[model samples]
Target: MATYDPFRDLDRLASSFLDTRRGPRRMPMDLYRDGDHYVLTADLPGIDPGSVDIDVDGQLLTIRAERTLSAGDGVKWITREREAASFLRQLNLGQGIDTERISASYDNGVLSVTIPVSEKAKPRKIAVSTASDSQVVQAHESGADEPQPIEQ
Candidate 1:
């Protein structure tokens, strides 16, 4: 009689499931703030640049792309698969964002977006003075002795 090990079988099943879930379906991105603009970058390889779309509605930002995998007329792929992808990322603009001036660019399999900050949100420079200009006067009595001039 052979004994069945449940732990060994569970581990193998979990590893296989994770492997199938990795690829273009789950793209990673990075967002950062640079000076007066916010930059967003994402990695999307083997995708047609013309098929990508970027949109901003209210405070939400969305990115989507579609790619069709096909083979030549004379050749055939043993396994043919078509990939369609979409990413939804919402950013809270709060009260100090200039959405009208936003710009975007794509290059080298990477997408970059620039969102400008509002004028009110930028830092301002203020000047300070350390000198006082108030005037003071003191009156002397009529009978007072001839005031002696003080030497400088």
Candidate 2:
């Protein structure tokens, strides 16, 4: 025999009223730098691939998606927990990012974006030269590139 719990029913009612999802929701994502580019992955389960929209405006990146539940004309929901919802997320891309080369793909309910780093932002080594040991010492002492010899 199942016992009736008034407190449990009250808690369920309160949760139903408070947990109703309306408007756009935020999706969880992960971003990390891989080699010369950044990879961003977001979870978007139960979303149609065609419904996923990604946009890059200036330095801002925005992702939007919609999830819809099927409801037939004669169907009645005995316990409806999942509802139709829209998901949105935006990120600010800083300098050194190659926005023009940004690419994205969706597979297995996961969205991935690749942001390449600009060539100018890459690390490089500079070559150093010295005219002579004496010149180097004199230049350092005089705080100049080359020390002029005394005219006799």
What overall lDDT, based on C-alpha atoms, would model 2 receive against the true structure? 0.88
RMSD of every prediction: 8.9, 7.9
Q: What local distance difference test score does each model get?
A: 0.70, 0.88
Candidate 2, 13-112: lDDT as tens digits: 8988898668799999999999999999999998998999999999999999999989999987799877688999999998899999999999988999
Assess candidate 2 and give its TM-score to the true structure.
0.75
Predicted candidate 1 versus true structure: per-residue lDDT over 41-77, tens digit per residue: 8787766888777777886666776555555689956
Reference-based TM-score of each model? 0.59, 0.75
RMSD from true fold, candidate 2: 7.9
21 Cα displacement, candidate 2 (Å):
4.7
Q: Which regions of candidate 2 fall more than 4 Å away from where they truly are?
A: 1-13, 132-152
